[model samples]
Target: MTTRSSPGIAVGVVGAGSWGTTVAALTSANATTRLWARRPELADEVNEQRTNTRYLPDFTLPEQLSATSDLADIVRTSDVIVMAVPSHGYREVAREVAEHLRPWVPIVTLSKGLERDTQQRMSEVTIEEMPGHPVAVMTGPNLAKEIMAGQPAASVVAIDDPRIAGALQRLFSTPTLRVYTNPDVVGCEVAGVVKNVIAIASGMGLGMGFGDNTRATLITRGLAEMTRLGLALGGELGTFAGLAGMGDLIATCASTQSRNNTVGRRLGEGESIDAIVESMNMVAEGVKSCPSVIDLASAAGVEMPISEQVVAVCHDGRSAKQALVALMDRDAGSELG
Candidate 1:
C-alpha cells in the first residue's frame, strides 16, 4: 500500500470538476494529493474553504486535499498525475502537462469519452503527446456525488503494465471504495466510451414512458453493440461483461445523476438539444461522443443502430420518437450478430 507513510508518490490531479475533485479527495486518503483548477477563483475556493462551489458544492473536501491554479507546480512536483479534464480539453491539458512533467511519471486519464476529431481514446491522446511515459485509464460505474457521499463502490484501473496497475489500484482504493486492476487498457477504454452513448438511448426510453422491459432490451442490445466494436478494435470479450462495461452502462443509463441520461431524457420530453446544452453546467459526453462513436463503428464495419439513431437525434435534429421508430424498423437478425 502506498499510503501517506511513504515520503513520495504524491498524486497530482488536473481539472477541478466534480470527478476530478472527488478523485483528488479519494487519493488524499492514501497519498499527498494536489488538485489543479483552471480558474483561480475555484482554486482559491478549494484552498480556503475546502469546497468546489461550482462542481461538488454539497460535499466538503478532505483537509489533506489541496488545490492550485499553477499547472507546472503540480506537474513538476507530483509523482503521479491524473488527467481529469473532459474529452474536449483532454488533449490540450495533456500537451500542456507534457511541457513540465518529469520523464517517467505515470499519467492516469479519468475522462470516459473519445476525442471529437481524432476519435482517439483519452489514453491514446496522452500517449501521442507524452510518448514513453506509462499511461493508464481509471473507469467504472462510479458516480462522483455517490462516491463523495461515501456509498460503497468499485472501479477498475487498466494499464498495460501489471506493476503500475496494481500500484494504482492501491493508490485509489479506500475502505469504502474497492479498486480492481486489469491489463486490458483497450477493452476498458472502449467499454467506457460506448456505454455513455448507450445510456443516452436508455434515457430516451425512460423519458418516453417506456417500462422495465424496454430498458432491459436497450441495455442488452447496447452491450452487444459495445462488444462488437470492442472486439473489432482488439479488446477482450470479458471486458464488456466487466465493471467498466455492463456495470457502468447500467449505472449511467438508470441513474438520474448521469448528465448524458438527463440530456436524453430532456430530448425525449420534447426539449431541443441546443436548449438542453445551454442550460446545463457540465458536459454530457454522449452529446459530443455520439457522432465520433458512429464514425468508429463505421470504420470498424460494425452495425450500431442505436448509436446511429442517437447521433441523428443529438446532431441532426431528429426527434427522439423518430429515432425509436428508425431502430424498430430495422430488419431483425440473429442475437449473436
Candidate 2:
C-alpha cells in the first residue's frame, strides 16, 4: 500500500457508471485521479465535455480528473484503487487488474449485491482474485444523483486495518461528505448486499399502494431479517445499525431513485421482468441478487421471509398479492421472535 503521511493522495476509479462518476467527482482532492471506462469514446467525451453526459448528466467533472479506457495506465499511476463495477463483474475485473496492480495498494469496493453463483461479497471476490492485497468497502445512504449535486451525505469506510480506513477517511471526505471508519469488514459487506433484497420488498409495498403503516412495518421487519441473516453469517449486530445497514436500507427502500425499487415498482405495475430489464440499459441489482440471497439464507438456516417472498415473486412468477398473503399466513410468533 502506498502509505502517505497527508490526506491528499492519488486515487484510481475503475468503472464509469453513475456511482463511479459520482465518486470520482467527489474525491477531487487527489492530485491525479484517473477514471477507467471501457469505452474510449466515453473517456474522450468526459475529458472534453467536463461531464459524463451519459452517466452523470448534470454535474461537470473537475479538470484535474482524467478519464481513460486503459487499465494499465490507471493501475500504474494510482496509489489507491476503487472498484465500482457490479458484483457479477467483480471477479473478472479484479483478476484483470490484479496483474498490473502494485502489491499492497489498498482497494476500496463500492459495489453492493452478492455474487449469484459464488454467493460471495465484493470483498471476497477481491481477495480471491488479488491475494495479499488490502481491501475495504464504502457504503451508506448515498444516492448518486444527490451526491453528484453536492448534497450532504454520510458514509462508512469498513476495512480490516484501522490505519487504512483512517487514510481512506481523509482521502474521500469532503465538506459535504462525512466519512466514518469501521473495522467490521464482513458486517459491512453483508449489510450492503442484503439491503437490496429488502429494498425490493419495500418497493413492492409502494407499488401496491400500501399506506405508511405497511411501509413502516416492512422497514422494521426488513431490518430484523437483515440482522438475522447478518448474524447467521457471523456479522456484528451493531454493524447493521450503521451506515452500511439501516442507512443504506432507508435510502434504497424508501426512494424512487433506487434501481432496485424501480424494478420492484415496475414488477408491481404488471410489467414482466424480461420487459422491464430489456427497457433499461442499466442493471437493477436486486433482480440478480434475489436468488443468491435466498440461497445464502437457506444454507445458513436463517429465515428471511421478506427476501424469500421477493425471490418467489421475481423468479417463480408468483403474484405480489399471493406472495403477501403467504407471508401473512405464516405461523405467527412474538414480535421479537
TM-score of each: 0.98, 0.96
Top candidate when judged by TM-score against the true structure: 1
The candidate 1 region of ten consecutive residues with least summed lDDT is: 1-10
Among these predictions, the greatest lDDT belongs to 1
TM-score, structure 1 vs. true = 0.98
C-alpha lDDT of residue 208 in model 1:
93
Q: How close is candidate 2 to the true structure, as a TM-score?
A: 0.96
Q: Evaluate candidate 1 by giving its C-alpha RMSD to the native, one decimal.
A: 1.0
lDDT of each: 0.92, 0.85
lDDT of 1 at 297: 94
Model 1, stretches more than 4 Å misplaced? none
Candidate 1 C-alpha lDDT tens digits along 104-201: 89999999999999999998999999998999999999999999999999999999899888889889998889999888899999999999999999
Q: 76 in model 1: Cα distance from truth in Å? A: 0.4
